[model samples]
Target: MDRRKFIRNTAATSSLLTLGGLSLNSCDSPRNKHITILHTNDVHSHVDAFPNDHADFPGLGGLARRAGLVHSIRQENPNTLLFDAGDIFQGTPYFNFYGGELEFKLMSMLNYDATTIGNHDFDNGIDGLLAQMPYAKFNFLSANYDFSNTVLDGLTKPYKIYEKDGIKVGVYGLGIQLDGLVTKQLYKETVFINPFEVAIDMETKLKEVEKCDLVICLSHLGYEYNLEQKPDDLKLAKKTKHTDLIIGGHTHTFLDKPTVVTNGAGRDILVNQVGCFGVNLGRIDFYFNNETTVADGYTIKV
Candidate 1:
């Protein structure tokens, strides 16, 4: 394929790269409306492309490649949203070398809509996250993490809303219990709240107050823990009423498709997670009608 055609095709695959707001063949007709939600989690600062002969991933994932995908998706669809589920620091040499400055800068460049906080995000302590805050242009959504006494106070919001082509979207975040996972000194003064309660409040507000068409939770509480004990995405989705989808992280789950669960009102709650790094980009395409609402998601390996 020619360079132009190859670039166009590449954008059609990656979540972060798109032409404008849409992807190729994204809109079947003028009335056939579509919105795309592109997401990543546990990226771990893999700034540069992987080595050519790496065991698992070779020259597969990178910020630049992801950006090209985002650009192409946008060009094909008018309504598109891009996000990260967290753990934006550590893993690759970028975090060890630049201390998350590069990751934040790259996300900002790719125009990430929002992101959540993960346990590894505290690897450099609360100060490390705070230091790189200035470089990030997107909002940090964390409803379950109370930063009252920490340096992160006021740096995060419970949730935010986005409207694309009149499709109202409410997005919030849920963090895991950092007690045993992270050091007290690292996440100093950061209070961990009940994830269920936060979800209740956020969904109520989003559904009742914000009047959003769809509600999404960026969860770092893993995908599904030992059934009822852990606060995984499945449990969160069950308790949630207004939440329509949950983009999850922290467990490094590799899901080919989103799992659908019923909420308190018996409404479908879609939950998804794309392994880790830039290896795969999670893409959820929603098709909503005034009569009924619908959405679906799957992974696109990059």
Candidate 2:
């Protein structure tokens, strides 16, 4: 269960989205129910605050601030989901010294619902991640990385569904292609599959088989790339179907507001990515009904 629960005041901000002269935000009337999604990405082993004299970021990101923010969100909305998007390893002396033990332990203490594996996570080899798996209380969802022959095989799931207040929130993860990013020796036997195809399969099972009301993707594929390059969240949003929202990382992107895109079916799909090192906590509030009508939602800083 999610353990980072706190209590606070929640303000309601409502706006009507007209979809071809049809309203999507008001199927019934404004309701009391709500679900808040809190996420982080590319937190490259920044367990402690940056030094006071650091040039770029000073006294910024740390687990304490992030945990406090997440706790406040869960407090505001009891039904909340917290997630991390890859690169949980290899950034600071913490990972180099403790070998990811601190990462798993800290995340576990924060009550993260799930996370995906990034190429940097394979820095110590797949064995290292699996070695620290027992320290994590949450599951690591990876759909594109095939771990058939690696020590990580059969340890992770493709997706997970959570039923909170009659809301079926389905979340899955897509890792990046690690060919040039990671050393072959480190990620040995871990085959990288097509994210677009894998996303389709996971979406089908989540929407059709699992019958989730909302399907979210925890993606480590950066938000965008150079022209003609399609390995990014913006491209994934256009290429896939049934992906209601995409929370991404791996580019150290800090989006003040979430970007809205059109899906394969021409429906609204939102994409968001918070900067790395737990500097900011990404928050999106979705309020829906029995039919269509989700809006831009709201975003908050940690």
Per-model tally of clashing residue pairs: 27, 2
Per-residue error for 9 in candidate 2, Å, reads: 28
Model 2 stretches with alpha carbons more than 4 Å out: 1-32, 227-229, 290-292, 295-299
The estimated TM-scores of all candidates read 0.88, 0.88
lDDT score for candidate 2 against the true structure: 0.79
Give RMSD to native, each candidate: 8.6, 6.2
lDDT of 1 by residue, 111-189 (tens): 9999999999999999999999999999999998989988899999999999898767889998999999999999998
Candidate 1 TM-score, true structure as reference: 0.88
Model 1 stretches astray by more than 4 angstroms: 1-32
Residue-by-residue lDDT tens digits, candidate 2, 157-238: 8899987777788999999999999889888888889899999999889888887767899999889999665589999988
Q: For each candidate, what is the lDDT?
A: 0.81, 0.79
